[model samples]
Target: MRHAILITAYTDFFHLIDLTNSFNEDFDIYIHIDKNIYVSPICLKILQSFPRVKSAEQVFHVNWGGRKHVDAILWLCKQALSLSTDAEYFHLISGTDLLVKDLQQFCNFFDKRKGTNFLEYFLLPYQGWESGGLNRLQYKHPLDQLNIKELHDRNVYNRFVNWQITSRRTRPLPNYPIYGGSSWWSLTRDTVNYIYQNYNQNGWYDRLEDTFIPEEMFIQTLLLNSPLKESIVPYNLRYIQWEHKHGSIPAILDEEDIPKILHSCALFARKTDSRISKKLINYFNNNRSSNL
Candidate 1:
């Protein structure tokens, strides 16, 4: 099974390139660098070192908790699927992620379950949301309101969009049952194309184009509403320890977490920094399956 690994990266370009060194010739890697930040010449050279690496020519200045996050992902997927012909499986991971096993180990695992796709998905408003259960889909976050420039300065645009705001979404919501999950997954090439087509087809994409952190819901909602609903996996495959009660970034992996990561059956462990976790990364690199 040929693998197309799609990555979303903004910072830590050297670390991102180091992470890609884990996968060999068999895996084709495609990356989308956030346009908000700049990459130095040396780091960009390292990122393009491997022949399989494909970078997005048209990058987005993605804003946190903004719709551009989803757009960047779609842009990467579009490039990977278009260029790699034998692309059987597409894995979506972030810059902070490290592949914990050998490429062949992952290949053999997916080869057995050829038809199934692995993605964490939950029917939206499923009891956990305390404040706004279904309002995530109901509220409209305009592009101008969520722009990084506008919010970073915290100028009048921020004040104007706050309590004084007097606008509600004029567009009607899609009838599909909203789904929410972690914004990462391993999916089949066919399903990847399915999502890309459905989201760009017509009215559905427009309905939630401005939804809050649409990346978290767009793909989940798309998969659940389609025939692939039964193939969904309800758990995230990455072993991330969430120490913060409510924060977007997961706690960085430490040497103490090595045992758990090696035994969890998870293919990747994320938010890893090569600068800090050299001991942990070396352990996995040295212990990769000999069968590969």
Candidate 2:
């Protein structure tokens, strides 16, 4: 049974190298590099050194209200499926992620669920244009209250227009359902193929991906609505600390967080910066070979 370490990265290519080198487990690495990010010569060299890494050239310029992120991930999923049809599990990891356990143990734990999924689900707000549709139709936005400027540039503008002009215009609108969960997941081949085969037919997926993709919600909703919901493990194995109350993303890991990280009992922890790299290196050097 084969497994893959799939990553969607922007500027932190080196961090991947550091993590990859420490893990001796046999797994293929597939990366989606954002075209907008400027890759340095050193980055290219590091990427080439990893024999298992397949560099995907296709990049998407995702915008705040655009479907580009979803498009990029969908493209990556198809590429991964084509490259190796035998891959049992596709483990999605971020550029900022670090392994907390030995690679063998990680593989062992997942091997038990060879044909299952690790995706979870929760209903959350669907952002961008989709939100606008619910606000207008569901809340009964007055004709003058409709802001065309907000709808015109959003990726779902066309869908919104159709809904607005058609049966939705005069009918009582239903609440817009959304999804949320950990962005990271380990998907079985069966589920992966299902997504590739029915990319567009599903109304909720097509509509959801229009604004948010490769995040907590999109995959959660897709999997929940699929036959593999029974296989989903409710909790993700990553440990993340949303350091501040106001920040959208988590705080970068520093030296001070090492002890806490070592005891987190998670397979991986994310957002480690150069400040914590030495501690990370030392920890891996001391414990990388162990089952811990």
Highest TM-score: which candidate?
1
- Global Cα lDDT for candidate 1: 0.76
Every candidate's lDDT: 0.76, 0.63
Q: Give the per-residue lDDT digits (tens) of candidate 2, residues 1-292.
A: 6777777776566676776665443677777776667777677677757777765453675443345556667777887888866778787777778777777777788777667676645654434335533333233222222223366544345555566667645444224444566677778888877877876545654455323233555677667666777877776777777665223357666556678877775777776654445676557546866654
Output the lDDT of residue 181, model 1: 77
User: Model 1, 1-292: lDDT tens per residue?
Assistant: 7899899988777678777777878888998888778888777777887787866343787876677888888888888889887989899998888778777778898999897888877776777553333555565555524564554545643554453335643444566677887788998888998988888544656666656677878888888888888887776677777664123347777678888997798998877776676788777777774546
- For all predictions, the C-alpha RMSD in Å is 3.0, 6.7
TM-score of each: 0.87, 0.74
Q: Model 1 RMSD to the real structure? A: 3.0
Candidate 1 weakest ten by summed lDDT: 156-165
Task: Quote the lDDT for 10 in model 2.
Answer: 68
The most accurate candidate by lDDT is: 1
lDDT of 2 at 33: 71
The regions of model 2 sitting more than 4 angstroms off are 56-58, 125-177, 209-214, 245-248, 290-292
